[model samples]
Target: MACMPDSMRARYDVVIVGAGHNGLTAAAYAARGGRSVLVLERADHVGGAAVSARPFAGVDARLSRYSYLVSLMPRQVVEELRLPITLKRRRYSSYTPVADGGLLVDTQDDAATRASFRRLTGSEADFEAWGRFYAMTAEVARRLAPTLTEPLLPRSAVRDLVIGAVGEVAWRSLFEEPLGEVLRRTFADDVVRGVAATDGLIGTFADVDEPSLRQNRCFLYHVIGNGTGDWDVPVGGMGAVSGALHDAAVAAGASIVTSATVTSVDPGASGVEVAWTDAAGRTRGVTAGHLLAGCAPAELERLLGGDDAARPGGEAPASYPEGAQLKVNMLLTRLPRLRDDVDPVAAFSGTLHVNESLTQLQDAHAQAAAGRIPDLPPSEIYCHTLSDRTILGPSFARTEAQTITLFGLHMPTRLFRADPDGSRERALRATLASLNSVLAEPIEDVLALDAHGAPCLEVRTPVDLEGDVGLPGGHIFHRDLSWPFAESDDAAGRWGVETEHPRVLLAGAGARRGGGVSGIPGRAAAMVVLGSAAG
Candidate 1:
C-alpha cells in the first residue's frame, strides 16, 4: 500500500482507473467542467496500447508498438480537447497478391485501380461491385458515425436509420447476416471477398460465418469511423495521439499519477474508495463522487473483488475475452520486391494482403480452430514510413529505412496458452513465410539490424499482450465488440458507458461505441457525470 501524498487532497470529484487515451479523454473533459479529477496509471508512462516505441536498441525508427492506424477518433473530440494530433489518409486502400499479378485499390487513381482490378479478375464488374458495396457502407457510416458521440439510440431506431438509407438487403447484409456470407454474396473475386472480410476479423477470432455474428460487429466498427472508415496513420506514430490527450488532460488541471497500480475498488452508497500502491511502495486511498473505469471490464470486476462471472448483467460473463492475432513489428532497411512487379513502395504503402484470399482465410481459420497453426497464415502488412516519415530519426528520415507492421489473423490465445514461447515462435515463422510467399525476395533480406547486431523485429503474441499491457486474454477490444445500438428499452437514451453501479462508468473500449481508437466512451462517460452534476 502506498502512503498518500501530503500535498494532494484525500478526495476528488472524479477518479479514473487508468491513464490510457480514454481515461485521459475523460479526465480532460471532467476537469474542464470544473470537477477535480485524478487519473491513476499503473505504467510509468501514459498511453496503454496507443503508443510508439523504439523497440530496437539504437534504431532510428519510432514504431507504433500496438494498435497502429487511426479511424474511429472523432474530429469533435480532437477539436474540443484542442489535441495536437495529425492523421494522414492513406492513398492506397489495399493490395492483394494473386497467382499472376495483384489487385491494388488506389484511392488517388480510379483508372489505375480499375485497371489493376481488370488485370487480376479480367473485368470491371468486381470493381463496380466493390464501389457499390463500399457506397452502401459509406452511407451507413455517414448516418451512424455521428450518433456515436451522442446518447445510445434504441436498436429499433438504429435499424430504421440504416434500413431506410441503405435498403433492407444492405442492412441485413451488414448487421444481420454473417460478414463472410455478405462478402461472398457481394463480391465475386476471392481476393476481393478476402479484402472486405479482413476488416471484420481484425482482432476478433471468428470465422466469416460465425453464428454469433461477431464478425459483423467487428466490421461495423471498422467501416464507421467518422463516416468514411479511412484508417489514417498518426504523424508521429500512435504515441502522438496519446501524448496529445495526456497534454490536454494535464492542461485541463487533471492530476495524472503514473506507476500507481490500483489494488482495490470499494463502490458504495456515498462514493467509491480506490486503493492503490504508489511507485514508492506505499498504499494510498482516495474517494471520488464518480469513478470511470478505463481498464477492461474484467479488470474492473477483479478490482471489485469479483471474477468474470460476478457481474452478470453488466457485461456478459459467460466467456472470457480471447484475442486472435499475431502482431509483428519490424524495421526494414528497404522495402522488399514484390512478385507482381508492382513498385514495392506502392504495394507496401497501404495494406498489403499476404495469402489472405477468401478461401485462404477460411482455411486458416479452420486450421487454427482445430488447434493447429495455419499452413499458410493469413496476414497483412503496411509501411508506416511511407505515410509518415517523422517517426524516423533525422539520420534515417532521408534513407531507405522503413517500419513495417504485420497483423496476422486467426491466431487465438488458445494456441499459445499451453506453450507461449514455442507457439509464438511457430506463429512468427508461419507469418513471415506467408508474407514471403507474395514477395519476390524474402523479407529477411531487408531486415534491419539493431545496434546490438540483432534483427530489428519484435513479435507479440496474445499472451505477450496480456503480460505486457494487461489485456485480459490479450483481446484488443478488451472483449468482443457489441453493437452500437441499445439492445433493450432500459438502455435507450442513456450513455452507453454506464455500468451496473450508479457511480461507476466504463470509459474504455469495452463500452458501447467504445472499440478502436475512438474516445466516444470517454466523452459519453464525462457527459453523464456532467449531466448528473448539473441536475
Candidate 2:
C-alpha cells in the first residue's frame, strides 16, 4: 500500500509526471530553486526501468534488471545535485570471439589488444583503422558532448563544430552516411565491422544500410557520452543511481506521490490541471504552472485524450515507437570457461559479443523484420560482478557467484506481439544458443539455482517492457531518437524538451538528446522553467 504526501496541497509551482530518474532530477532542480514541486509516479516505487531487483526467490544477489550502464549523464548534473554515485570503468573494453581466436580490446593494455587483433585478423590494418576511427570520434565527442547540456543548436552549427573538430571526411562519415555504410567502408574484416556496427544497433532495429539513418543517431549517442563514449557501470547497480536522485529530490522539498496514475492533464491559460487516481483509489487533482511529462510521448498523448496530432513530434505516424531488444538477467554459480585462452574475467568483464559479426547482424535484422525470430540472434553479455561486486549479498559476494546480463539485438515487439509467451521462449532459446556457440560449455551448466531449485534466469522482451515500464510499444528511447541539433531553424535555441503544449515539456527519453539512463532532459526542462539556458 502507498500513501499520498502528508503535506499534500492543492497546487504546486511545478508538477512532474513519472518518478523515474528524469522526473526525480527535475523535481530536485525545481525544488532546489525554491519552487514547490510535486512528482507523481504510477509505480509503487521510483526508478522506472533503471532499477535493481532480486528476481529469483530467496536470492541475495541484486541485479540491474533493466537499463544497465551509465553514459550520457553530464558531470555537471552530478556535481550540482551532489549525487553520491560512482561509475566504475571496466578494464577491458570488449572481446569478440572468432573461430580461431578472439579480438579482445584491453583498454589498459594497447599492446595486448594489438596482439589480439593481429592474432584474429592476421594483420595490423584493421587495428590501425580502429584506432584512427575512434580517434576521429574522440575529437567529435569532445566538441559535441558539451552542447548536449546546452540549448539546441541549429543543424549547421553542430555540423560546423564536428567538421572543425575532426574534418570534412569525419563529419560526412558520421553524420551524412548510414552507420552501416560507414562501418563497411571503415573496416575490412567482417568481425571488425560487426564490432563497430553493434554500437549503432544497440537498441535500434535497423540494418547498417537502413535509409532512415536511425542507426546513425543511435551510434552518435553511444560514442558522445562524457566526451569519451565509455559506458560505465554504476556502483551498486542502477537502483543506486535512482536512489541518489530520489534522495536529492526529497531533500530539496519535492512532494512525491507513488502509485498515482495520472488520469487527465488539462493545460490552459492560467496553469495546468493534473488529475490522478492515488494508491487509495481516490481521485486527486492539482494545478501547476507547468507539467513535465517524464514518460513516453505516446503516454502523454493518451493522457491528453489520445490525440495523435498533439504529440511532441506532431501527428502520430502509421505506428507507435517499438523497442527492438531482449534483456536477460542471470545469476551464475561460477563463470563459464571460454573456448579461447583468454581469461573469463577479461572476456565477460566488458562486452562479450556473440555471433554479432556485421553480416550476421544484418541477416538477423532482415529475419526479424520479416516476422520470424532470427535463427542465430546476436547478443552481448556482461558480468557486473567483475566490475563491481557490491551488488551481491555478503555471502554471495565472498563466493564465485556472478551476475550476467545479456542484451539481444533485433528482437522487436512485433515478433512477440502475436504470441508473446511463445516468442519469448523461442527468442530466449535462440539467444542462449547464439551465446553458447562461442563458449566452452553450455551456459545452462553454470546457471545458479534459487531456493526453489529453479534456474535464476529471467527474460524481458519489448512487450514485457511495455507492460512493466509503460513504454509505448516498448520503445527504449520513448521514440526514435531525434538528431541532437534542432531539426528546423525555428526550433533552435529551445531546450528541445518543448512539446506541442506551451505549458508542458517532454522530460523523458523522447526529448531531443534524451535517451538511455541520462537525466539530461529532466535537467534541461528545469533550466527552461528557471529561465537559465546554461544550467
Off by over 4 Å in 1: 1-8, 308-318
* Candidate 2 backbone collisions, by pair: 180-208
TM-score to true structure, per model: 0.97, 0.97
Q: How far in Å is the alpha carbon of 28 misplaced in model 1?
A: 0.6
Which lDDT tens digits does candidate 1 get at residues 271-301? Answer: 9999999889888899989999999988898
Q: Ten residues in a row with the worst lDDT in model 1?
A: 308-317
Question: Which residue pairs clash in candidate 1?
Answer: 1-282, 1-283, 2-282, 2-283, 3-282
Query: Looking at candidate 2, what is the lDDT of residue 463?
Result: 86
The true-versus-predicted C-alpha distance at residue 476 of model 1, in Å, is 0.5
lDDT of 2 by residue, 77-136 (tens): 999999999999988889998889899999989899999989988999999999999999
